[model samples]
Target chain A: MKLWEQNIRKVKPYVPGLQPKEDNIIKLNTNENPYPPAPGVERVMEQMKLDKLRLYPDYDSTELVNELAKEKRVDPEQIFIGVGSDDVLGMAFLTYFNSDKPVLFPDITYSFYDVWCELYKIPYERPMLDENFRIVKQDYYKENGGVVIANPNAPTSICESTEFIRDILEHNQDVVVIVDEAYVDFGGASSIDLLKEYDNLLVVQTFSKSRSLAGLRIGYAIGNKELIEALNIVKFSYNSYTMNTASIVLGAEAVRDKEYFQNTVNQIIEQREKTIQELDELGFTCLDSKANFVFATHKSVPAGKIYEELQKKKIYVRYFNKPRINNFLRITIGTEEEMNQLIIALGEIL
Target chain B: MKLWEQNIRKVKPYVPGLQPKEDNIIKLNTNENPYPPAPGVERVMEQMKLDKLRLYPDYDSTELVNELAKEKRVDPEQIFIGVGSDDVLGMAFLTYFNSDKPVLFPDITYSFYDVWCELYKIPYERPMLDENFRIVKQDYYKENGGVVIANPNAPTSICESTEFIRDILEHNQDVVVIVDEAYVDFGGASSIDLLKEYDNLLVVQTFSKSRSLAGLRIGYAIGNKELIEALNIVKFSYNSYTMNTASIVLGAEAVRDKEYFQNTVNQIIEQREKTIQELDELGFTCLDSKANFVFATHKSVPAGKIYEELQKKKIYVRYFNKPRINNFLRITIGTEEEMNQLIIALGEIL
Candidate 1:
């Protein structure tokens, strides 16, 4: 090995879903919202002054944070914005997961959790999810450095109740508990209300799923002022200007049109219900999902074969080959016509 | 103390230059270009499809990276992109400075170097610059984990020759050497050509200063394929989509208009030389600067008082209150008209 190689920090990186370059394909893999962002976002983009590109963006991201604070009904001091929720969660892991005791999460949850632990050298343990793919609240009740729960968990497409979250929080009050609500807008209940009682609880959300601004890369966290201040300190230490000019201005527009935001989220939820019914009739068993996606397994056909067969028909869905969940496929809810096409494609594959 | 607070990664953040909110002020603190970005950037923004923002950006940032590789005459595999030069440098510190041995840099270089070291818990030593505020190349010849040098070092506005950089690289062949050329396009000689001989060398540059896209937050690193690969791994591990869609698309357009980039850079150089001449006549001893800024100290008045006086006249310039540089004001070069106003204001204050 080269002598300089000894100083290299090695770790496996998280592989985001395939974004096929080809235009004509059904892309339901990454859980991105099928609809475009709010109309106000388009208006903001059109009217944005390109001459301002010469100046550095506001390092504080005041406009976006103020808009979010007003929308979420939290003080501006309670919020911390980042490039995305992934960035927010990554910063949280760096800031809050420094103890020697292993941080706790479910064995089957967002795959990025463990990757972050490895990158920061934070000891972490994943307790197994129940057979129903539910986040067993008791598993996180033990003494640990910290706890992270992905409500409306990915791949499993299951969201635990607010009471379940409270149970975990009540037990782990000594450590920071991060509730990743990336999909809460679709159907999952938010733990944000619990923030009134727990200072250690951090509720993280994103623009990628419900708001349809994944391409813009905006996300934020709402918590106690002290917790947010700590996150800001670490963030500024890392990069003072994570948000850009267009993101700050356009993201504020996304927050302004509340009616358009609700309408798009409602459409996704309605389509999700209809898609689930069709999958059930096709000899497929799907978990009860409160997210923008569905997790289903055919009674006879292996998910790997079904995934490949659907790909042949220009339909894409996420299929993780990890242990215990190999039989399942996570399909994001697309438009009405797209969902019909997906149903037809699934029937043929089965 | 709160139990959860114990795990907080506490460190003093690197405070960025002031970005005043009020308009019509002579903003010259952050080293930003007075001119706008390339015309192609404006065209790209006008024609961008808002609907495509529903999908995630290309994780590889293929288009921007490919364009940059072609422009720099390097392979696509030899480049890494980030939000800004600060983000690129911070990632480099995390990826390459993992050895137990201390990293080496000049004491009077970019202020963010020590903050990054503290954030990552990396042992680092700042070898003091000579009395003239110039990096002594031999000081980096000692055994250390890595070396970083800012060509045309910030606040000091002093540029070192390519031969000086090559001398440091020759001795530190076994460790990674990062030549931060954030201000190189103005006049400083880039050490990018030395990448051919040193496998461990990484050259980082930014669009904020030369390309006039600070508001968009675009930066990149060019180096050996292995070194670039390591940076990509760490970037992906931290945030898979650090570059958003607008940044990727608009950054490519900025690179396409090479003539506009060169024209703007030439204008800034011309303004810088003129400003230095004016400052000299005003009883200020200005450093010989190759950057878009000039570091000058008044013959009688202190830098802090001069900074305050400029601000009172709505002319904002950077003043560092730290050791040695306490009496020097780093003044960014604005347009000719703005510089004339600044000279008039300084003449009155002195």
Candidate 2:
């Protein structure tokens, strides 16, 4: 080994879902929105003056924060923006998970959580989720550095109630609590309201899912002013200009077209329900899902076999080979036509 | 005080140059390029399919990296991209500066160096620059954790020779050495050629300065394949999708138009020389700058008064009120017309 290699930080980086380069395939592995961004995004992209790119974007991301504040019904000071929810959560991990105690999260949650912990060298513990893949709030009540909960957790599609979050917050008031709401807009209840009472609560949401701008890369957190301030301090210390010009301007445009945002989200929800019903008829046990995805296991067929068969037909879905989740498939809800194709592929595979 | 505040990572964040909200003012506080990005950038932005935004961008930033690799004449595996040079540098610090020993840098180098050290809790020592504000190469020859040199060092606008970088690299073979070339395209000789000899050296450059795409937020590092991999691992562990779609696409287009890139750099360099001569005539002592900006201090007038007087005339230049460099103004080279106006304004102020 090279002598300098000793100083190199060794880390097992998070593996994001496949973004298949081949076109005309049903691509639903990464839980990205299956619809285009709001119409205003295109307009803004077309009309934005290219000359202004010579200057750096506003490091504060003032306009984007103001629009998000209006949408979330929070003070502008309560909002903090990042490149995406991953960036936001990474910053949160660095900023708030500094105690000697290990931070706590569900054993099965957004995989990036522990990756952030490991990257920052922050000690963390994973409290196992119940057999139903639901967060056991009481488990988080134990003393810890902090807590992170992915509301409408990934690969499980289960969302807990605000009261459940409050229970944990009440016991863990001494540490910061991050409610990752990346999928909360997809029918799950948001814990943003809890911020009024819990100064330690930080609710992180992203435009990647409901807003259909994952490619644009915008995510934000809303919390009490102090929590947001701390997050901002960490962000500025890291990179003052994290948000680029297109993201700041186009992200606000995506937030502005409220009607289109709701329409696309509603369409995804409708299709999700239909797809879940079809899967059930095919003898697949699907978790009752609130997010824009479903977690399922076939009664007779092995998930690995079914995943292979579907992929052979150009239908993609997420399958984790890890413990407890090895037999399950996490399928992001696509458009009506795409969902139909996925259902038909699964039926044939079974 | 709040109990959770103890867990909050308190930091003195880096204050970026003021991005005034109001328009029609000459902006030079930030050393951003005055010219628009290559014309092809606008074409790409206009032609990009907005519908594809529902999906995530290529986290690897493959196309941009490939384009940059061809431009820089390096293997694709030797390159790593980030949101900007700051993000790139921040990741480098977290990845390569993990040794227990203190990192070494110039006392009056890029301000963000110390900020990153503080944020990441990396021990670092700033060796005092010579009285002429040039890096004393001997100081870095001593044992330390790692080394970071901002070629064409900021605020001082002095570019050390490739030989100077080689000397430092020859001594620090046991640790990673980061040569930040954020301003290299202006005139500075890049340490990229030395990479063939020094496996531990990593050279970072950005599109923000000479390419006139500061608003798009693209930066990269070229090094041995192993060092790039380590940087990528830390980047992926931190935020997998730091480079958004617009930045990736538009940044590639900027690279493709080599003619426009060189033209803009030449224009800025010409303007910088004329600005320096004009400032010298106005009784200002200007550094022998190889950067797009000039570091100048008035012989009789204080930098603060000149900064305020220029502001009153709707012209802005950077004036840092820190020790040792308190009386200097770092004026970015703008258009010839802008420089003339600046010279006229200085004449009147004097």
Using lDDT as the measure, the top candidate is 1
For each candidate, what TM-score against the reference? Answer: 0.99, 0.99
TM-score of 2: 0.99
Residue A343 C-alpha lDDT in model 2: 81
- lDDT, candidate 1, residue A339? 93
Q: Summarize candidate 1's per-residue lDDT along B124-171 as a digit string, tens digits.
A: 999999999988888898999999999989878899999999999999
**lDDT accuracy of residue A179 in candidate 2:** 92
- Candidate 1 Cα errors over 4 Å, as ranges: none
lDDT of 1 at B181: 95
* DockQ (model 1, Cα): 0.89
Tens digit of lDDT per residue, candidate 2, span A9-92?
Answer: 989999988888898899889898888898888998899999989889988888899998898899999999999998999999
Q: lDDT of each structure?
A: 0.92, 0.91
